[model samples]
Target: MKVDLFDFDLPQELIALRPVSPRDSARMLVACGDEPFADKSVSDLPSLLQPGDVLVFNDTRVIPAQLDGRRGEAKIGATLHKRIDLRRWQAFVRNAKRLKIGNVVEFPAQVRALAETRHEDGSFTLKFEGEEPVELLLERAGRMPLPPYIAGKRPTDERDKSDYQTIFAREDGAVAAPTAALHFTPQLLEALSERGVQRETLTLHVGAGTFLPVKADDTDDHQMHAEWGRIEPETADRLNAARRNGNRVIAVGTTSLRLLESAADEDGIIQPFADDTSIFITPGHRFRAVDGLMTNFHLPKSTLMMLVSALMGRERMQEAYAHAIAQKYRFYSYGDSSLLIP
Candidate 1:
């Protein structure tokens, strides 16, 4: 399909600059089957589903991956995309014309990295120059990698350090937050628990690529960036058992949904997986693992929009987005939420 088919005009003022005071206070647009769209609150999620239904969350923590540094007189900006190894990371560099292989970029707090190699897509492999762990180096010199849509409007601050991350954040590596889970809070979790909603976790280090727009004219030409994820055997067994017991396995974010789909076999049985997945979900794709999804409003003509359109039909999602816009709900990473059940 033409990428233009997914395009929609969104008012700039509707884009969210920050989340609501209480995380669960954000508005949620519920789309279930052929039912009329229901406007609700994130706190009301427990009442939206049955007791046995499961909600899978991404526990990958957002690392301080945005770096501003200099190589000689030229200023270089780097957003770490993926972990290549213990000391080396693949990053998207801003001042690429000024950088070359073997040059060291000097960062704040004396943290420095050598530009080891440039990939085919113009990204660079930066190897940190120290015996200390790279995580420590990042803590000293890096800033949270906020999506450009939000960062362009205002600067990232201390508040965003907590706002951008979910309560389930633990295993650290992601450059981008799984924004859907950002609405979750301890109180909300307690309510869901009392309501008997099963919760599970997996890791998918959401990369900077999630913020990239679809430059392809057609969906067939778009290539998704690979992100590392893991699913243990016990988790897979439980998910399968839930499906066997006629329970719905609803993913809390596209990150979790993609990983679940990646782990599922043709028969829809999820297997233990620990690897990179570049699954590009489009309209005609068959969803094997997940029964529903909870995610944030996405950018126009983005791969995420395409993914959601795949779950719901294209026309239905188009209508749903229209409804969201008309209702004046927030948009983007820090925006309101949506519960999509097909």
Candidate 2:
């Protein structure tokens, strides 16, 4: 399908610069199939879901992956997207043409990296100078990698250290936050528990590629970037049991949804998985693992839009988005969320 089909007009003011106070206070637009869209709050999640339904959350934590550095006199900015190893990372660099293979870029806090091979995707492999854990080096040298749509409007600050992370965040690797989960709070968790809605977690190191636009005119030409994810045998077994027992599996974010789809077989049974997934979900794609999705509003012509379109019908999602915009809901990473069931 044409990428233009997903395009929609959004006002600049609708883009959220920060989260609402008491996280769960953020608005949630419930888009249920063949029903009128319901305007609700994130705190109402317990009531929206059934007792036996399971909500799968991505436990990947966001890292301080943005770095400002220089190669000689040329200033360069790098946002580490994926981990290549303990000492190396794949990053998208600003002014990347100034860098070459084997050139060392000097960054603050006495950190430096050799610009290794440049990938065809326009990102570069940056190998840190020492054996010291690159994660530690990043702590001293990097800032939270905010989505460009938000960062371009304002500067990142100390508040982002806590604001950009979810309560469920644990494993450290993701450059971007699984924004949908940001609405969750301890109170919300307790409420869900009391309501008998079970929660499960999996890891999918969300790379900066999630924010990349689909440059392809047709969906077939777009290539998704690989993200490493893991689903343990116990978790897979439990999820399968939930489905077999006639319960729905709700993915808390696209990160969780994609990982589940990656692990599901043709028969829709989820298997234990520990590998890289670059699943590109479009409207015609059939979903196997998840019954519902809770996610943030996405950008126009973005892969995320396509994923949501696949979950909810394209026409249905288009109408939902139109309602969201008309009602003045916030958009993007720090934005309001939607509960989509199709």
Candidate 1 deviant stretches above 4 angstroms: none
> How many clashes (backbone atoms < 3 Å, residues ≥3 apart in a chain or on different chains) does model 1 have?
0
On residues 51-122, what C-alpha lDDT tens digit does candidate 1 reach at each position? 999999999999999999999999999999999999999999998999999999999999999999999989
Candidate 2, run of 10 with poorest lDDT: 130-139
TM-score of 2: 0.99
Segments in model 2 whose C-alpha atoms lie over 4 Å from true places? none
Instruction: Report, for every candidate in turn, its global Cα lDDT versus the true structure.
Output: 0.96, 0.95
The residue-by-residue lDDT of candidate 2 on 74-179, one tens digit each, is: 9999999999988899999999989999999999999999998899999999999987888899999999999999999899999999999999999999999999
TM-score, candidate 1, is: 0.99
